[model samples]
Target chain A: MTEREALGRRRRVVAAVVASLLVLGPLAWFWWSSLVPANASVMDMGYPDTGGGPAAASGHGHEPEDGPRVSVATLTGPSGGVPDVELTLTADAGPIEVGGRTVAGYTLNGTSPGPTIEAVVGDLVQVTLVNRSVPDGTTLHWHGVDVPNAEDGVAGVTQDAVPEGGSHVYRFVVEYAGTYWYHSHQVSHAQVRGGLFGALVVRPAAPQEGVEAVAAVHTYGAVPTVNGSTGDLRVDAAAGDRVRVRVVNTGSGVLRAWVPGSGYRLLALDGRDLHDPGRVAEQAVLIGGGGRADLEVTVPDDGSVRVRLGSQSVIVGPADDAPDGDDPRSTLDLLTYGTPTDVGFDPRAVDRRFDYAIGRRPGFVAGRPGLQWTINGHTYPDVPMFVVSEGDVVRMILRNSSGQGHPMHLHGHHLLVLSRDGAPSTGSPWWTDSLELAAGESYEVAFVADNPGVWMDHCHNLPHAQQGLVAHLAYTGVDTPYVLGGDLDNTPE
Target chain B: MKTAYRVLAYLVATGVFVQAGAIAYAWFATLNDLDGGAVIDSDWEGNLGHAMHGIVGTMVIPLLVIALLIVSFFAKFPGAVRYALIILGLLVLQIVLAFVAFGAPVVGALHGANALAILGVSITAAQRVPRSTTTTDASAPANAVA
Candidate 1:
């Protein structure tokens, strides 16, 4: 080979090597840049150097401009025994965005899942529901409301589904407090799944200070509103202030939860007080349908805490809180503007604990997704029936192995949950019916085997409950004739 | 004279490997950004990790393959041809062994066989090549008089 040719070849090789190096340098940079997780905890991402670069024209990303806003903070109400509540529901039944797609829904005030109803124990609630959607109207059934006999929403029994554009007013007293929800009486699966149900947080008669709650709306049809998982709302307090967090699973799936970075101790569940509240420290509270727990959690050090929402989080921080009764400040406080709250979870304080499992049973004969609910892998029966013995410290472990959610209901009795999603509901404790248990979720509740006779534990979606997803929690009785249901004529014998 | 070029070529190939390693590392770190579960940490960490996977997965592996090729090619010195082919054969065997050994009860046996083959042939090739030892025969003249 000629010397010139050799020299040229060498030069070409050198060029290729340099080119490769140049290419690798940028590729390395690109690789390094992308390696960081999208959600890497930026809490410690280098502190902003506040005054560096000549700030460019600010409007970079078309960030949504915050407009007229409102916050949900403190709510004041006249003190009394509020066992029942009533409201006129004008359901604007129509198509709405759920899971990003528009689908039919039973919305109150043009919103799916209705409005959030906050009430305390000993209050009477009267609701008049006007269904303006489906060809066949609907009846209002408080999924987990502690109400009277006549007001029970059973189609053809309690009252025929108020015809379309028809109205029915339900009046009942709030017997307990906790995380309860409401939905249609019959054919509710289709409607509630389409957006008819909502959160009903019943607080204690003497509410705990700095305790707050938010009804997290879960819908596959709708993207999300506020709380990503347990719903959205925040509370702020100075260090040592007891912070209560009540989680209500309103979707058709078992909801798993934890405080993420925050810590707290659980106190009670299902409205049933604890034999010893200290057990909540190490106890994992799992609330079945119609259950509630009071958690006692101290605020963390000044900074921000992102409440883990399954796979996401809602940022909670130590910021200024609204003075005594500033409405807007209260609302903004719900969005996490609160002062330092020095509170730590006392693992020894939890007095009660139970085991709940979330599992699914596949039928070899069937191909479709089968019934998904909780309570020891058993689906609730259509005609509610149960067998229970007295003197049993009823520790009910609700394991939802199914793909859908079931809000188990205990007719006459209430149980208390010490923790939720393996985390305790710090300070906020109340009672009610219809605790929403999401799919693949588990909850633990304990109650005295006190309420005799057969009680109902089933999905709140009346249709799902009606379709054999109901169970009977019956207490044994040999002294007299064991009768079930408040009115025999309305319920099947 | 030609050896100088070969030596330089080997250095270039080695550089490619280091660069590839850096690329692979980048991909490993960004996995979470891909909206993929925390292949590392599953939290609110968003989906950028996956979006950058293309750069790491695509750009790095090819460069390493080229480096390996260069390394294999230069493995052509005195006994390099025979030694390289044997080593190459063992490499292929190890790859096959790795596949067969996966989830198999005979994994330990397969691994032992792979190590033996690589070591036996490599030693044989070394024996055939000129050694730097004092008793070396090939590098010195068989007959000093000639």
Candidate 2:
């Protein structure tokens, strides 16, 4: 062939390649990536851990305490909601500083994350919510609760957003208990993101021994947190003491709470007990907003070791693709991610079977297009509440609906995973405060109606909660019309 | 004699587009039907591979062989095709490595590279139609050589 002809052919090849990228290239990508199992790396999403590399915070351990102890209490809005007690919430102003300050925010009780409410399951919660900012009106959503239709906190839907200087008394009989949370259902991404949130732990009737703690999970932009804090955590526990730590995922973040050096046995997730308590040496407890995981840890002979709380990194495998959700291996996280959990409990009987799916969808992450994460066929519902009776032995089959794996967690109730991805995890020495639900993977989680209240089940990644990947598992009062054996969900029989 | 392969390349390109488009269309349609915004927000990249898992997981393995056949016709032993296949081959490798790495940054980087590989395959497949009487390598030198 002539040199000119060869050059012309080369140009054509170049143009073809360009055009193909415009057309066939995307097509090839579609087929190779779309048509085949995702060889795409979970790490390809390129999310930077806010607390430096997760491992930088990995090896911290708690030093033994002599006698000094810090008294940590739940705060609140005028009416208890996501905050321990509900107070007048100030709407957005300039960049409001929360936690240590510097970032823009919305304030509740003059602080970000509103308040932390600590109450027993059966206590009568009397909260007077006062909204002082934003003329558009503000409403408090008792996230993870089964309030009446009129009382259900939705801006325009259930009730009007509390007006500037407007106050509403939120009185709810805390029936179902566990670590549940609340936030403004309206202007969710806006207000909640602005710092109008907190932890709500409804103390269970039969509280376990050792230490009882609350860790609220949420996201600060791309960051995930527990009680709005990352890095080190310490709760006073005597040696060999069975400590039960409660977490309320209020900020729409996933939480991984584990005592790194401590042997944390997962007691419950989503306020439900596991069929078999799976002991995790390096455990990952996934808790979304309104999701809770109870861990029973025997404070080691030593005082404490640092427990890491962060998103799980996915493991890439041969065939270049991760194990699909259906494949048991694919559901596993690549990172040695973990959070300590509660001890095991005896089961009454296998009540029923239900499944849930978690995943991401197209354009889930901004830079990353055509990506998404979801649970079941849906992610978390952006609605104010999910209605149900209290005290029911619920079995949720958690399936990771999207490509990303999520650490599924629940609020207000700790649950035990009866199975992972539909197979029996019960026999796998099951006990977990949180467990990993890989992409397209599912797990069968079971628990009793011991804790009666509204609960949340969602991915434990803090940001996931803010984006509305949070679901509510409501437990109405036993006297309610929707009783489980009768209505199939009320707290007590 | 080699011209026959040119026609085949054109056919293959056309086929890839059709299949990819069909898959994309299905994905778009399914996404549209659900309240994706309420839950997943708005991202489609993660879904494509997952939605295609059934076809990709089951069919792609077999197609790898066919893709190999197509590659064989275009270039000499393992040079061009091997380059493109490297990214494709990373799928299985990633899963295994993740198990070892515990989902750390090393595994993360490999995943990022695989995504780049997917992008490379798409570009190469589209550009193939115009080249003739030239060694058609599916991957760039960096991709191919590595």
Candidate 3:
């Protein structure tokens, strides 16, 4: 071969090597950087976001050794006392009937939408969880109850999941009376969707006169159900009787609920009563994922009333001929629905301000490349750790530019809605634990950092949370003995 | 290496076709659902067609393009490197347009147009590979440009 031809061959080979390197180099780096350690503390996972408050000396690392340390395991409810309400729930995997069709799913106490647990205000509630045939372990989270950190039931963060045939106990005091729920938090994206959940209702000290019902809405596969049944939940009521229905959305999306025949009042939200809520008619109420809405309706004298819940319905009065409702075009704006009242705490007197900006960007998560959700432009484990001190009034601005809607949920605290899109909240000092934010929507909320522990603040759309749309609100000087992906194999999303 | 480059380019072109078909199916299915009283809103989880489009567009085609770029260096065909680079550039632009289209759906028109551009460039790149050329030596007629 000629020297000139040989040189051309050599140069081509060199160029090939360079091109391969250029193509593979960044990919390898991103894959390596996206890896999360099998066992790592929630405290050490992400960067510290001070939220303009006092900066931690450790910068989201371990607490300063010189200062006193508090472990999350020590944060518990009152102990060594007789439980006011006690029950045991067993989780098992089997083929259950959803909408009269059998589906492979998980169940609690031999039924999906397991038995409702009722309590009065200021009563101590205790529950024992027993995992039976579930391959993946299970832990029950007291949704919107604001239990102590140890009783929060988040696997790998608050405690380890209960393995098969193993048992765990959770005890907390019910401080307020309204609608709430419980669901498995381990492998929650799948377990909750498969129906390992139930309703929790707390009543007032005085006996209520009206008929009460619970409509725990869930979707098993593509079948929407209420209280584990496919058809409308029927209530036997006479004419001129008053009925209160508690609606809980356990699915991973927004739920639109409306009444077609009779007007209803949105009595409560997220287990809190609205102040002087007026009557609502011809408008649907949007309940975000993991949210609750209490509606009060007066049975019509002539016909039955139908409450449309997403894809399911609840019929009151005579069940034989209930009026089916249409999905309303207009939604009730909670921001201006009720009369305003003092919310007890001043939102303007804030100690910390944080920005939780949700966006989507192309990146690698756990070595998988796609368009992943970002919290403040950073993905999981590298996302923000909102640091706060106990008793501080924290104000946060949540912005969603991700071209999708997210029902943002914060554990252990109920955020008071101050405003949305710069418009002040004129209704009943709206409070929520799950706040829905659509694309290009922004909300300002405030809450007191009275619950001191490591808490998860994530999207209630479980799949999105698994896609790195998760962050945490951690208190200073507080650490946890548990870790994610540890020997327990706890996967908490 | 020349054969590998050609196969990858053809695969990318086929991927564009799959994307077009999948998105079309997704919209048609969505329309049928809406007609049957299914509310399309934030709560709507897309149908299977959208999932297919996403997987192919994001993972399958991009990987093929990268492989083609690597093979182009050693293929030794005239204009092979230039064609591969153009295809890669168009694919990158296609992805960016897709993301932007979400916030402003009007930009979806551009995304649709760019997909055609990618399909065209990918086919052009594959055609640049000389037909039935097995010889890799310097004496082969395929290396005349070199």
Which candidate's lDDT is highest?
3
Per-model CA lDDT versus the true structure: 0.44, 0.45, 0.87
Per-residue error (Å), model 2, residue B21: 28
Give, for candidate 3 chain A, the lowest lDDT window spanning 10 residues. Answer: A57-66
Cα lDDT of model 3 by residue, A231-275, tens digit? 778988888888999999998888999998568999999999999
Query: What order do candidates take by lDDT, descending?
Result: 3, 2, 1
TM-score of chain B of 3: 0.89
For candidate 1, lDDT tens digit of each residue in A1-493?
Answer: 6898577556645654564465457645534532323221111121211111221221112334343211111111223443356567777667776434565566765776677777778777766788676554565566555454235554433345566667766665676666566666556556655566666777789956674555353543324443322234455556556665555545544333444434545544444333334322212344433244445556556654433323333444465321111111111001111122322233233323333343433211011122223334433221212334544455556666555556666555554544555664444333335566665556655665543332345555444554445544433331112112222212211
Q: Against the true two-chain complex, what DockQ does each candidate achieve?
A: 0.02, 0.04, 0.39
Of 2 and 3, the candidate ahead on lDDT is 3
What are the RMSDs of all candidates, in order?
23.7, 18.8, 3.0
How far does residue A263 in candidate 1 sit from its true spot (Å)? 1.4
Candidate 2 fraction of reference contacts recovered: 0.00
Q: What CAPRI grade goes to candidate 1?
A: incorrect
Highest TM-score scorer: 3
lDDT over C-alpha atoms for residue A410 of model 1 = 56
Ranking by DockQ: 3, 2, 1
Error of 1 at A157 (Å): 5.1
Please identify model 1 stretches exceeding 4 Å from their true place. Answer: A1-86, A98-101, A222-240, A273-296, A318-408, A415-455, A459-467, A471-493, B1-146
- Who wins the DockQ comparison? 3
